[model samples]
Target: MTSPPPHVAVSNYKGGVGKTSLAQGLTVAAAEAGDRVLVIDMDAQGNLTRRLRAPLSPNPDERFGASLADVLQRPAKGEIERILVPCGYGGIYSERISVAPTHFDLELLARTAGQAASERRLLRALAGVTDDFDLVVIDTPPRLFCHLIDIAWTASDVILMPCEGEYEAVEAARRVKERVLEDRHTLNPDLEIAGMVVSRYRSNLTLHKQRAKEMEKIVGAEGICPTRLPELVAFKNMSEKALPIVECGSEGRHMASLYRDVYKWSRDRINTVMKGAA
Candidate 1:
């Protein structure tokens, strides 16, 4: 019997585009829906780590006790539970949600000159662990590096590309799709794009609306999520409080609704992909 593929990864090569926020929202939504979920911080900036209060390090070698870096180096010995930090809301710490914390060491790994077979490190590290959770959403870095490529090609069964509904962002999505196809042909043959999501949308802005239409043309209407997240202050508030929007109170209700849409869309995509594979 074959194991199930991990849920998906929210990734893009552009920074400051709400990648981490989307990851957190999806993880929280899934957990709240009673699915065991794990969020992996794969960026060197460690925004996710800081948000969850995970351990940090000034140097690569001195980071968290167990991290994605450690798992890459020793998959057989590394366990997700060892590195995972539980993020609770209203004093809740259930098995529904966990985070595989990372640190600056990720950048060190990316910069290493002689890192042979590094492209497959993440794949090996995550082996034998997909079955442990209902989903494992990875927050990839904003640049193309060994770690990003490795996770994109090896670990990701589905890719969720988030855009800001701008021409530049749409162009970036095109490039990302091309890269995904290229990687699938060579490394991970089963990889597929789950869909595209428009974040920070403002219907009052003609430019934003036009760009959204253009993006739908590029990725297809069905490939684009129907629920576009409006530009709201609530998201920023969630970030400030270091909590998922769902747990942030009545002010966060809008953000929580957006997360529910994402959770439903992602679940449908995963089910579709699984059915196709079967």
Candidate 2:
């Protein structure tokens, strides 16, 4: 079996903090750079799957007929590759991105995940099929201290934290950081915390500013991303239309440029972390 590419988990264990958005943005960055990227939706809400409008033909060679649930729960070793549907957006990156979808029923896997062997399910699933991609981006769920998140993190080489500038968001990120520490001591000693990204930030709000500062302390000033994404209608519009900022024409292109450095920086961190482990 071929070894999988570096799997970066875009997560913060906080809901509504733009984790999926960041995952999509990362995929866009990979695709724009002409890299074959695989996006796996680990959230039971399946927001990422629905946003991508999966089951569409990615290419004429293979068809997607399974879900993320099938990849983990089913005994089939080939399940992972079978579920790689194309993401909805088919612009210039049409051939560059693939998605493994999920739905609400994915919640059913929680019990299975609680089992002792479940922690390595994602890794087992990916062992046979990840050579086709340059990188793997897993959109983790908001729920924390659970088997699902445990399995995802254990499978990842790096964890990319994305949070909102809010009290709950900061608290949740701290919880995740603590869990990651436990991970380093136990399940995945090589797992690295890439950095923290604060999204939906409002510069005018004192609470937002304070929370951002608190997050900076959590990841260190240099560990915090400088591109604080504000609450913008454009982001909402792009998400509703299921389009990555890079595909929305001039305005989208301009907005995506703001994230260019951030994405590259995160990617660099991911690579560095992976290489160090190697």
Candidate 3:
């Protein structure tokens, strides 16, 4: 029997949003909850990798080694173990999270390969090590680049599209949904959207709550996450510290609790999806 796919991609077409933070939150939450999680930093900006403090090569052209770009170039023959680096902040309760680090040079991989090949590279690279992690969370680039397309096609078992509380963000989610549908029909038949998460919610702003309600109407209530991560200083602080909110004490406790809510919701969604498929 074949093993189950171990990938989930967090993507959004809009920039300056919380795509990276959501990905980091999920990875950290899953790991702390006793699941071995792996994060693939697919964005060329390297924000996720840098936040996690994973090592990267100074040389960009190295082949089939630690970088995600190299692994994608020749995934069938490369060892996944060699590429994952342990990333955890120093603390008594710091959770162990591993990542496949990548560099901005990864953008070149998408440019060189044809559309189909570029879109499938992440899926092929991930196939080599599905069993190693209970979950693999992918952080995709903002635009509809080849790497993002490949992530949509191969690596994603579920697409978690995070939208800010804005009209534009809602529309972008719809576009991403359309792309996902195309991907499901053509590339990964098993792919489904896990849900749409509303991030950076500020109850004080009427526009934020109004847009969020409109988004729910568009995406449906079943796809909405129960917990709305409030705009908090701790989130920014944690990023600066390269640590999950859960790792930081008093200042971050509330944010950590919010993350836990998302974690339970995600776990439930995964179980439901697996059972429904079975």
Please provide, for model 1 over 1-278, each residue's C-alpha lDDT reduced to its tens digit, 9 standing for 90 to 100: 75564658787767767788888788788877877776778786778766655555566465645676666554552355566766645344345667777776666565543567566566666666666777888888876545555654576778787889777778877877888776676557777877788888888899998988888876688778888877787878777777778667775887898888888997897677657765
Over 4 Å off, model 3:
1-6, 59-64, 90-95, 115-118, 274-278
Every candidate's CA RMSD: 2.6, 3.8, 2.6
The runs of at least 3 residues in candidate 1 whose Cα sits more than 4 Å from the true structure, single-residue gaps closed, are: 1-5, 56-64, 88-94, 111-116
lDDT of 2 by residue, 68-120 (tens): 66568754554578677787788756688888887665666777864776777
Higher-scoring candidate on TM-score, 1 or 3: 3
Q: Alpha-carbon error at 85 in model 1, in Å?
A: 2.4
TM-score of each: 0.89, 0.88, 0.89
Q: Candidate 1 has what TM-score?
A: 0.89
- Model 2 worst lDDT run, 10 consecutive residues: 56-65
Clashes of 1: 0
lDDT of 2: 0.77
Highest TM-score against the true fold, candidate: 3
